[model samples]
Target: MGANDLAKGPQMRTVIFDLDGTLADTSGDLIAAANACFRGLGLGDLLDARHDAGTALRGGRAMLTLGFSRVDGVDPGEVDRQYPVLLDAYARDINSHTFLYPGTMDAVTRLKSAGYAVGIATNKPEGLAETLMQSLGVRGEFASLIGADTLPVRKPDPEHHFEAVRRAGGDPRKSLLVGDTATDRDTSRNAGVPSVLVTFGPGPHDVRALSPEATIDHFDELDAVVAQLIG
Candidate 1:
């Protein structure tokens, strides 16, 4: 039997979400943190939000490394050394520039009201993820928040997705992941679940080209897409 077939009774349905690029535009704040580190080093804004947004979504070290690459004296070791500092800075001001994509709360509310268990499965660190969600006042909406450090491994590694679904009391085979990167697509594929990629994320990838099960340019289209994919 397929996952839905097995879940014919009262088993919970689930929708797993990616945080940074998918649920919210966290690049501005993320970049601010990296820029803070560079400013401390007297570099004074080595990375520009418009240009390095994709790298920002990739994580702190990626942003730091990209910034260091543009300067003469900096090296990879410097990026490593400043990684924690960036995280600390980001943690302090996590919600300053971060806002949910339009229609996010509406879509999430629809899912919850419809009895689907919602959860986050992001590559962001677990603690940071919790802080961000709480800062945004949406922490209680999700049944679970599984992050990079929540388990021994992260996305594209099926275990991460599986754990998120399980924690939400949903069957993995019946779950769907809403994300905005190739990594998220690969994670869904590896976990044997349908994937939906958002086109509005800061990532430079052509989400449609990622060949996710579905592509949504806006959160307004999410409910129908989720229904078609899993229901």
Candidate 2:
């Protein structure tokens, strides 16, 4: 839809998304990366791809910490020590098991056609996020891609969301965030923007607890949710 043209004027409204567990289900690959780290330490697949998926989506450090907790007499700085290994492993084979959720591309195409600027704001490291998107062949779909290292601060911090909106040439005040976690909900709240939480993530979402502006069970419901929130 030629939606991300930098020369074009800002769209009246914007819809930013969280990458992991939102536009894509990246848990399998993430867990695999952490397992690589554990395997290197002779831990041998400490994390189950299906069971530890929720931790995987949280990020490499979280997965390492969880794995460490299950073991006895582990080094105190093991997570930090293995983080680089995890990232290296993840980057080497980022897209092996990662996949866009059903209707993700369709929803983005529909939103762009409808004149809403779109972008990604994620806690994933910028380079990995960029590589993953490029591998999945949807990097161009987003007008902007901001990551954990993109700014000095990240999610649950308003500027991270604001920067993505600005980069997308859209007004932050008239934007909404679609994500699947409490961090996303807090980011939207901190930005004074509406939030749409997804229930089709690695696990069931406690929507009432997070208390975002809205929730959706699938990407097919996203367009309507976006329109209802910001249009």
Candidate 3:
């Protein structure tokens, strides 16, 4: 459908988002860092490893663990050692290949201007989430952000979502979680909020199997999804 078709929809109240593949496409830089870690240890680099990283593109740390796990008998310390290299590489090139998904920034800007509370809730670690948002010039863009380490538990546990809702100053009934992973789906369900799943990321299983409230392949479809949730 055309943009005009979507514009006829009613506005939404509050929308929470996932980072990584859902908002920013960090796979290219993350793949570079993961491979840098592998090459630092004198292992043969596989393009498939990078592609594998695309599926679980939560953050640098998760990518590191996923990439390094391919090497059998590798010590956790070795993985730990590689993390600094990844972090250092990413610190310089975080936005090099990472960008907001199409129409994402526009949607976010419109929502904020419409008086809707906006927040970010992702499985990425709390510290890096804040740092990346600021570094990429979208930090203050979110009224609230909840990362994996933000609380004693993470996604798949509803407390994190509850905390994000509290921070965004919205009731769960008026909020929508937009993400691309089963973990995100579970978080929404457990929090008693609606979720919209995007079909554009690496997830271990089919997103539809998780039973999100809605599913779409583009950010352009988000307005209707959000309208249904927050109406």
Comparing 1 with 3 on lDDT, the higher-scoring candidate is: 1
Residue range 1-231, candidate 2, lDDT tens digits? 466663365546999999999999999999989989989999888898988888888888999999989899999799999999999999998998999999999999999999999999999999999999999999999999999999999998999999999999898888999999999999999999999998889954476579989998878899898988998
What would the TM-score be for candidate 2 when compared with the true structure? 0.94
Which residue runs does candidate 2 get wrong by more than 4 Å? 1-11
Q: TM-scores across all candidates?
A: 0.94, 0.94, 0.82
Q: Rank the candidates by TM-score, best first.
A: 1, 2, 3
**Cα lDDT of model 2 overall?**
0.92
Q: What are the RMSDs of all candidates, in order?
A: 2.7, 4.5, 7.8
lDDT of 1 by residue, 95-172 (tens): 888999999989999988887899999999999999999999999999899999999999989999989988988878
Off by over 4 Å in 1: 1-10
Overall lDDT per candidate, in order of appearance = 0.92, 0.92, 0.76
Q: Which pairs clash in model 1?
A: none
Residue 202, model 1, lDDT: 84
Candidate 3 lands at a TM-score of 0.82
What's the TM for model 1? 0.94
